[model samples]
Target chain A: MRNMAKGSFKVQVLQAREGAIVASVNRLLAEKGYDAMTVDEVAADVGIAKASLYKHFTSKEELAAAAMIRLLDHALAFLATLEAQPKATALERLKAVARWTLQVQLAGEMPALPAQNSTLRAALAANKTYLDRLMLVSDKLGEWITAGQKASQLNRKLPPELILYTLFARACDPVLSLLKAGGKYSDEQIVDLLLTTCFDGLCGHAKLRLA
Target chain B: MRNMAKGSFKVQVLQAREGAIVASVNRLLAEKGYDAMTVDEVAADVGIAKASLYKHFTSKEELAAAAMIRLLDHALAFLATLEAQPKATALERLKAVARWTLQVQLAGEMPALPAQNSTLRAALAANKTYLDRLMLVSDKLGEWITAGQKASQLNRKLPPELILYTLFARACDPVLSLLKAGGKYSDEQIVDLLLTTCFDGLCGHAKLRLA
Candidate 1:
């Protein structure tokens, strides 16, 4: 029993260290994106030896995959809360997810999802947890999108996949960073503006002056 | 007079080689993005020796910047054409530029502009021709945005800079590629759909079923 307790304690410490490493990877990705992030730097950021870092992640690809998995996990958790909100409209839920993405991006916690990095793409494709959670998030969003389309809340003409990809792209939308760099708006204001633009677009209604 | 002709011929050859190098860099950046692209690969693709390639572009950053300058030049050229169309509305001109961006991107001629590559950013910042032309492009677009707002064509509530960035962002928009990847849409269809989304947005209008 004592040996088992000691073993449990060791496992806890290992898991805790791994969590810290993933956090550093996430932050580095958020700051400089995958191309600029270095494994040695991640190790240094986490106050671990390079060998120890390798013991956990093994490769930069794996490190990125882990961070992405964490992000997807957060997304899935957020989706779950929205799923429970029985009173919310489908479009309202979609907006909530978009809002969450902007908030995460503003807080510097969102990883810049690599659009064309082949290695990172391969790593993510092979990551079961990442793919599973991504699918879950997509599936959840897909449901809302279909519902919104049926209700005429979202344009039914667009493929639901386009809507999903557009919302996902919002997580790394350069407009957020540009607005942040301008120092003209608070984070709340920035999120609201992007949310409006994402759903309504750049058109003028002449009446409300917003689409 | 004979010597001057020979020197001019030599200069033409040098210019031709530089153009080939920049084209290769542009294609590679489009295919692999800035992070996956390398100086060696560019040299190889250009059918030149690494040493010879260095004679044209000193570094990868410089090469990327040159490609960006080429892209900006194309954009300026396109804008000039739009400016000459005196009968077009400000909104029509904006849509033309947006369509041109989508077409250029689909043709694989557009360089993936690095959003956070610090080295590339520094090189672009230091390039006077690039900065000047970028400013020109921005100024032209800014004028259209102002005119459109005044005409009640574009949303007056949104800032003009946001409109400009949103349109610029369309050049690198992942939605176009995603839709293409789904293999259901033609190039013309892709450009038109993206252009409509850029101008009208994703909101379903009870009237047109698009914002």
Candidate 2:
């Protein structure tokens, strides 16, 4: 029983250390992006030795993948909370997810990955945990999207994948950072404005309503 | 007179070579983004010595700035042509610009820049030619945005900068590449679909129109 207890305590400590490493990697990725962020910087940020950092994550790509997996897990948990809110419409839930992504971006927590990096893409594709969480999140969002379409909330003319991609695109939308940099609006206002454009578009809302 | 004619021919050849270099840089930027694209790669793509390429553009950032300047020039020229039409509505013109950007992105001509690169930002800022062309393009688009808002063709509640950023965001919108990668939609279909989402949004157009 004492050996089992000691083993459990070791697992917890290792898990905590891994979590701290991921959190540091997430911040560095957000600040300098993947290319500019070095493993040494991540190690320094985590206050750990380079060898110890490598013990947790084999490569920078793995570090990024871990950060993404953590983000996806957070998103999955958020979806669960939204799922519990039975009163929210499918479209409302979709908007809430988008709002959460934008808020994370505004708070400098969203790691903006380079879309064109094939090596990173290969790593992400090979990482089973990342792929699983991504698919899980995609599946949940897909359900909401289909429901929204069925309820005539989302555009039925557009394909479900297009809508899904649009929502995912909101996570790295440059408009959030640009507006945030402009410093004229609060974080809530930035999310609301982008949410409007994402849903309502640039057209006159009154004109569309009147039409 | 003969010497002067030879000088003119030499200048034209130099200009053409510079154009080819910029074109190669543009394609590389689009394919790999800024961080992944190397000056050596740019030189090799242009079939020139790295030292020779440096003679035309001092640094990689200058190469990127030149590509952006060329793109802005193309946009400005397109805006001029649209201006001459005189019959296009402000909203229609804005949509045309957005469509053009989307089309360029689909064609893999759009140079995707890193939004968070401070050094690149400083280089671009210090580049008078790039900054001037950027301002010119922004001012032209800003006019259309203001006109659209004034004519009640765009959402008045949203700031003009928000609308401007939205249009800019469409150029690098991941939806274009994602949909393209899916191989389910034709390029024209992709552009039309994104344009619809950009202007009308993700909401049911029928509901908005019927309302």
Clashing pairs in 2: none
Candidate 2 lDDT over residue span B1-211, tens digit each? 5547457777889989999999999999998999999998998988999999989988889999999999999999999998998999999999999989998898889998998888999999999999899899899999999999999888888889999999988889999999999999888888888887888889938332223
Q: After TM-score superposition, what is the CA distance of residue A116 in candidate 1 from its true location, in Å?
A: 1.5
Span of 10 residues, lowest total lDDT, candidate 1 chain B: B202-211
lDDT of 1 by residue, A71-102 (tens): 99998899989889899999999999999999
Error of 2 at A1 (Å): 11
DockQ of each: 0.60, 0.60
Off by over 4 Å in 1: A1-7, A206-211, B1-7, B206-211
* Model 2, native contacts kept: 0.79
How many clashes show up in model 1? 0
lDDT of 2 by residue, A1-211 (tens): 5547457777889989999999998998888888889999999999999999989888989999999999998999999999999999999999999999998888889997899899999999999999899999999999999999999899998889999999999989999889988999888878888888889888838332223
Identify the leading candidate in terms of lDDT. Answer: 2
Worst 10 residues of 1 chain A by lDDT: A202-211
